[model samples]
Every structure is written in C-alpha cells, then in structure tokens.
Target: MVEEAARRDLAAIAITDHDVVGGIAEAQQAGQRFGVEVVPGIELTAEWDGRLAHILGYFIDPAHPELVVGLERAREQMAAHVRDVLDAARALGVEIDEAALARYRGRYVSGATLVLGMLEQGILRGSPHARQLLLRASREPRPFSAAEAIALIHAAGGVASLAHPVKLRRSEPLLPARTFAPLVAAGLDGIEAWQIVQGPTVRDHYRRVAEALGLVATGGSDCHGPRSVGMRLGTQRVPAAVLSAMKQCWRDRRRALPDRTGSPR
Candidate 1:
C-alpha cells in the first residue's frame, strides 16, 4: 500500500488496525522506508444498545493506562472469541484448522488475520461471506462499552471517532455522520471525513454530515496487515492541522470534565 500511495503522491497515513496496536510498529518501519508519515492508531469495538460499535483511536500514547489496559482486556476476550468462532465453524460443517489461525495471530489484534486466512484459503470468499458465517454460527461477540472505549482513548491522550459504522452489520448508517447523533451528544470527538473506499458521493455525504453535526473530521488508511487490500499507506491525506483540531477538541473536553476516569457521558 505504501508503494501505491507513493505513486499516488500521498503524504501520510494512519495505521488504524482493529482492537490492537501491534501493527503500528511495523507500519512505522515501512512508512519510514517509503517516505510516508505513519500515524499510530487502533480501532476498538465497544458495545452500545446491545450492538457492537467500532471506534477509531488516533495519535494515542501507547503506554498510557487507559488505552493499554483496555486493549489488553480486549485482546484476551477476542482470543477466546476466536476459539469460539472456530468451534462454531465446525458446527456449521466448515473445519477451520488451528494451524491456519495461528498464522494470523499475535501480530495484529482484531483476529483480522483469521478472517483474511479464511478468505485466502477459500474457507470464506469475501468479507460479506465471513460476516454471514460469523452470524450464522451465532458468533459469540465480546464486550467493551462505547463509553469505556472512548474514555480509554481519551485517557490515553488520544482522540476517538466512530469507524466505518455502516460495515458493522447491525449498526445503522455505517458511514458515520448520520450515525453519530447520540455519540456526538456523548462527547464523540470526530468523524472519518474522507476515505479511499468511499466514492465521491459517500465522501460528500460524510463531509456534510461532519459539518452539520459539528464533529471534527479525520481519515486514515485502515491498514490490516502487510498486504492492505484496497488502500495503500498515506492514500488518505488528513492534514496535520486536522489532527491538531481533534486534539484541541480533546483538550477542551478534558478541561470541562473531572480528572477522574469513569463513564465519559
């Protein structure tokens, strides 16, 4: 992806891998090699109204307690969830080998490697197929409330925004602006204003939404592993000024709220 981005004349990309910060280091190394600025990030899953919501955390202090602890807890839950997923696949007449899973483990947190493995080996054909299999298997999803997830990101001195909300199945308005009314009220900081995957119309939709809702706007590469599918590193160019604006929003919120950590709302 980095090479592609370089060809496209892009400058920077944030590596927002799911629920894990493990890939940030590797992305940084490659970004350095490719002359792209690698922004560090993580995509976290939080429960809201009994459904899972994905949160993208950007520019975080990796060693801070809020983010580090929550991520560790999530990693543990997902590890167990992966085992359950394998078990459910067996029940559904698909045998997912443990060896296949091991190949995708540890390096990235979200079990995305596992999902990709299924695709690569024909265990699953695509993302939609994988999602259906998980649902049909009654995939035992894990827990981390939105409030908790956002707080962790904030506590780590980073900013949190809703991820591609539309893609998560149960969540409405996956693209975010229409989806974030309550979240914005709950101190949600930003929206992904632009994305490579979204065509011009979707980009316009999200931009208008971001403005209408008074939310900070951000973007990233959303890289999963070495082989990022559609997006290359630095493909989505978020001005450094935009990141500064998000952090300024965070500072404003922190000043208004008490130092004590708990429910952000």
Candidate 2:
C-alpha cells in the first residue's frame, strides 16, 4: 500500500484493515522507505440501530492493549461465524476444503476472502452464489456496538469516523441527521464525505451533514487492494487540509484528558 501510494504521488495514506492492525508497522516502515506517510488505522465493524456500521479509526496506537484485546475478541467471533458459514454451505451440498479453510484460522478472515477462497477452490459456483452466501452470513451478530467501537478508537488515541455512510443501508436512503446524531453523541469525530463509490452530489451531501454537526469531513478511496478493479489508490484525492483537521481533533482530544505513561489515552 505504501509503495502504491508513493507511485500515485500521494502524500499519505491510511492502512485501515478490517479488525486488524498487524500490518501497520510494516506499512509504516515502507512509508519511510518510500517517502510517503502511512496513517495507522483500523476499520471496525459495529452494530447500530439494528444494522451493521463500519467505523474507521485514524492515527491509532497499533500496540494499544485495550484495542488489541477488543480486536482479538472480534476476530474470534468472526472465525466462529466463518465456521457457521461453512456449515451452512455444506448443508446446501457445497463441498469445502477443510485444509484450505484451516490456513485462515489464526488470521483475520473477512467474509469476502472466505467466499473468494471457496470460489477459487471450486467449492462455490460463481459471483451470484458467493453473494448469496455473504448475504446469509451477514445476518450473524457483530461483537461490538457503535458506541463501544468509538470508545475503543478513543482509547487507542485515534479519531473515530463513520466510513461511507451512504453505503450503510443499500435498500434504504442515505442516513439522516437523526441516524448520525447518536453516533456523533457517542464520540464520532468525522464522516467520510468523499469516497470512490459516491458521486459529487452524494459527496456534497455528506460534507454538508458533517459541517452541520461540527464533525470533520474526511475522504478516502476505500481501496481494497492494488489489484481490486475500479478501486485505485489516490482516486478520491482528499485534500491535505482534511488530514490536518483530523490531526487537530486528535490533539484536542489528548489535551482534554490527563496524560498517561505512554501515548495519551
């Protein structure tokens, strides 16, 4: 990711892997080598108002004990959920490779990764089949609530932001003020006002919402990987000022609290 950022001439990029911070250290080192800044970040899954919401934590302490413990718990739950998904697939006569699945045991196993693995191993048919399995698996409960996610981010000395609010509900319309109110009250520091998936109008709408609520407006490409189609590095071109604002918010939070032995709580 750092190499790609440098190749794209990006000043900086955040490594917000879902439920994991293991790669941040290496990415940061690569950032130094490549002359690009790497923000230590994590994308956490949380439940809010009976739906799943993704929260992005920026400038986090990757080694924070509390954050590590919480993420470990979440990973365990996700592993169990993957097993349940495999069981469901077997019940439907889909053959799965137990050995291949075992390789993901101690690592972060996202639903998409699992599904794609199955598809690659010929355990699942195609995209439509994978989509069905994902839909079924998504019904499983998340381990953390939105408030807990925000608190965890804060404890890790990071600013919590809502990621791509427009995609939070596919069947429903964009999140209203009432929806964002609870999250903001729970210590959400920003909203993803720009993303590759959202057009200019949608981005403007989220920017307006962020401003109205006094939340920082952030943006990202939401890139999954270098090879991911249609999602490329530096696609959104978020201004440096956005990152500056987030840094200010982080500094303000640290000042409001008492200092600790290590990084501010």
Candidate 3:
C-alpha cells in the first residue's frame, strides 16, 4: 500500500481501520519509510435512531486508554454479531466448520468476511445471497449512540466527522441532511463532503451543506486496501488545506482542555 501510495503521488493517507487501532503503529512506520504522512484514525460505528451510522475520527491518539477500552467493547459486540450470523446460517441448513472461522479470531472480522466464508464453503452462492441472509438475521450488537461516539472521539483527541452521509442514508430511513443539525449540536466537527465513488454533483451538494452549517468538509478515497474496490491510490487526493485544517482542529481541541498535558487519561 505504501509503495502504491508513493507511486500515485499521495503525500499523506489515513489508516482508518474499522473498529481497531492495532495497525496504526505499523502503518506509521511504513509511512516513514515511504515518505508519506500517516494520519492515525478509526471508523467507529454508532447508532442513531436505532440504525447504524459510521463516524470517522481523524488525527486520533492511538494509545488513548479510553479509546482502547471503547474498541475492545466494540470488538466484543462485533464478535457477537458474527456468532449470531453463523448460527443463523447453520439454522438454514448451511454447515460451518468452527476451525475455519477460528482463523479470524484476534482480529476485527468484517461482515463481508463472514459472508465470504459461507460462500467459500458453498453455503451461499454469491454476494447478493450472503447479504440477504445476513439482513434476514437482523442480529446486530447495540452500538454507541452518535452523541456518545462523538464524545469518545473528542476524548481521544480526534476530530469527529460523519462518514459518507449519502451512502449512510441508503442503509437507513433517516436522511443525512435531516440528522446533520442534531449531530452538529452533539459536537460533530465535520462531514465527508467528498468521496471517490460519489460524482461531482453529489460531492458539491454535500460541500454546500457543510459550508452552510459551518462544518469542516473532509474527503477520502474510502479505500479498504491497495487495489481493493477498484480504488486507485492518489486518484482522489484530499486537499492539503483540508489536512491542515484537521490538524489545526486537533491542536485547538487539545489547547482547549484545562490540562496542558495531552496524555491519555
């Protein structure tokens, strides 16, 4: 990934691994070796109106104890959700070998992985079937509310942003625009105004709303990994100014605290 980023002329990148910070140190090391800036980040799942919402935390402290604790809790929840899905699959007459699934332990397991596991075992035919089966399961571990998630991100010395507001609406009934105001009131620092998959018009619409609301407009490629999801590194570069502003936001947040020391509590 570092090599690819360098090849593509990306000056910096954020490793916003889902629900975990364990990879940040290695990513930072690679960034150093490859001459690229690595923004420490995490994509946290929060609940709003009983639906799942993704919150992106930029410039976060990887070693923050509170954030660590929160991640552990989230991991447990994810594990439970995975277990439930496996169980549901079994009830549907799809056999699963426990040993095969054991390999994913000690790491954050994605729903996609679980679905793929079933497909590999010939339990499901394709992505569509896997998705439908998982949706039928309807067993998700409760997540932090949006307010709590924003508070946690702030506590971790990170700027909180609503991730892919447009995509988020498709999964749930609540419109992103409708929820933006309440989220801002709850301390949201920004919105993902630009996304690689979104066209210029969609990005512009989000940018306009963010500007109107006085919220920071952030963007990313939303790439999972090198060559994954057809995402080309550096194709959708985040502006240097946006990165500067986010860093400044982190600094200002730190300065606002009564304690001069920024150590994890």
Candidate 4:
C-alpha cells in the first residue's frame, strides 16, 4: 500500500486494516523508505442499533493495551465463527481440506480465505455461492458497539470516523441523519464523505451531513490490495487538508483528556 501510494504520487495514506493493527508498523517503515506518510489506523467492526457498522481509527497507538486485548478477543471470536461455518459445511456433506485451512489457524481467518479454500477443492462453484455462504456465516454478534469502538479509539489517542456510510446498508442508498446522531454523540470525530463507491451528489450529501454534525469530512479509496478489482490506491483524491483537520482534531481530543496527575494532557 505504501509503495502504491508513492507510485501514485500520494503524499500520505492510511493503513486501516479490519479488526487489527498488526500491519501498521510495517506500513509505517515502508512509508519512510518510500517517502510517503503513513497514518496508523484500524477499521473496527462494531454494532449500531442491531446493524453492523465499521469504525475507522486514525493515528492510533498500535501497542495500546486495551486496543490490543480487545482486538485479540475479536480475532478469537472470528476464529470460532469460522469453525462453526466449517462445521455447517461438513454437515451439508461438503468436503473441506483441513490441511489447507490449518495454515490460517493462528492468523486472522477471513471469509475470502475460506472461499478460496473451498474453491481450491472444487466445493464452491463461484462468487454467488461464496457470497451467500459468507453473508450467512457472518450473522453472529459483533464484539463492540459503535460507542465502545469510539471509546477504544479515543483511549488509544486516535480519531474515530464512521466508514463508508453509503455502503453500510444495501437496502438503503444513504442512511438517514438520525442514524448518525447517536454515533456523533458518542464522539465520532469524522465521517467518510468521499468514497470510491459514491457519486458526486451522494458525496456532497454526506459532506453536508458531516458539516451539520460538526465532524470532519474524510475520504479514502477503500483499496484492499494491488490486485483488488475495481479498487485502486489513492483513487478518492482526498485533499491534504483532510489530514490536517484530522490531526488537529486528534490534538484537541488529547488536550481535553486529563493526565494521570489530573492535569489536562
């Protein structure tokens, strides 16, 4: 990602991996070598009013104790969820390659990994079936609520932002402002107003919403990797001023917090 950012002439990029901060350190080091600024970030999956929401934490301390332990627990739950899915597949008489799955035992097990394993053994036909299985298997409860997620990010000295609101629900093109009120009240510092999937009108709508709620409007390409289809690094063309605003917000938040000596930090 850092290399891609440099190649694209992006001044900076945020590495916000889902439910983990493990990649930030390496990305930061690569950013130094590539002459691109890397923002330490994580995308946490949280529940909001019974629906799943993703929270992006920027400028986080990767080694924060609470964040580390919480993410570890979330990973364990994810592993257990994968086991349940495999068990369900077995009950349906699908043959799984246990040896292939074993490779992901000690690491984060994503639905894509499971689908690839199934594809390798010819157990799954194509994308449609893979998508069905993934959606069905992911109905389990999330580890944190939106409020808890924001609190965790704050505890780690990061700015918390709501990620991809337009993509949050397939049934609705855009969420109502009421849906964002609670999260904003919970200290959400920003909203992703610029996204690869949103059109200009929709992006403007979100930017307006963010402004009304007194939150910074941020943007990202939501790129996963170099080979990811239809997604390219730095495609959103986020302005440098967005980063400056986020940094100022982080600094203000830090200043508002009381230190161990009961003085403002």
> What ordering of candidates by TM-score runs from best to worst?
2, 4, 3, 1
Error of 4 at 104 (Å): 10
Runs in model 3 with CA error above 4 Å? 97-106, 126-132, 136-142, 171-178, 260-265
> Mind giving the per-residue lDDT tens digits that candidate 4 earns over 5-53?
8989999999898898888889899988999999999999899877889
Which ten residues in a row are the worst by lDDT in model 4? 256-265
Output the TM-score of candidate 2.
0.89
**Model 4, which residues run further than 4 Å from truth?**
98-107, 116-121, 126-134, 258-265
Q: Which ranges of candidate 1 are over 4 A from the true structure?
A: 1-8, 25-35, 89-94, 104-115, 122-140, 168-179, 226-231, 234-241, 250-265
User: Looking at candidate 4, what is the lDDT of residue 74?
Assistant: 86
Cα deviation of 42 in candidate 4 (Å)? 0.2
Q: Model 2, residue 253: what's the lDDT?
A: 81
Q: Which whole-number lDDT from 0 to 100 does residue 103 have in model 1?
A: 63
Better of 1 and 4 by TM-score: 4
- The order of the candidates by lDDT, greatest first, is 2, 4, 3, 1
Alpha-carbon RMSD of each model: 5.5, 3.1, 3.6, 3.6
lDDT for each residue of candidate 2 in 1-265, tens digit (9 for 90 to 100): 7887898999989989888898899999999999998889999989988888999999899899999999999988887887888888787777677667545433456565565567567755654466677676556547799999999999998999999888889865466666699999999999998898888988898998899898999989998774346547898899999989888888888887768323321
Winner by lDDT: 2
**Residues 39-93 of candidate 3: C-alpha lDDT, one tens digit per residue:** 8898888887676788999888888899989988988887777877777777766
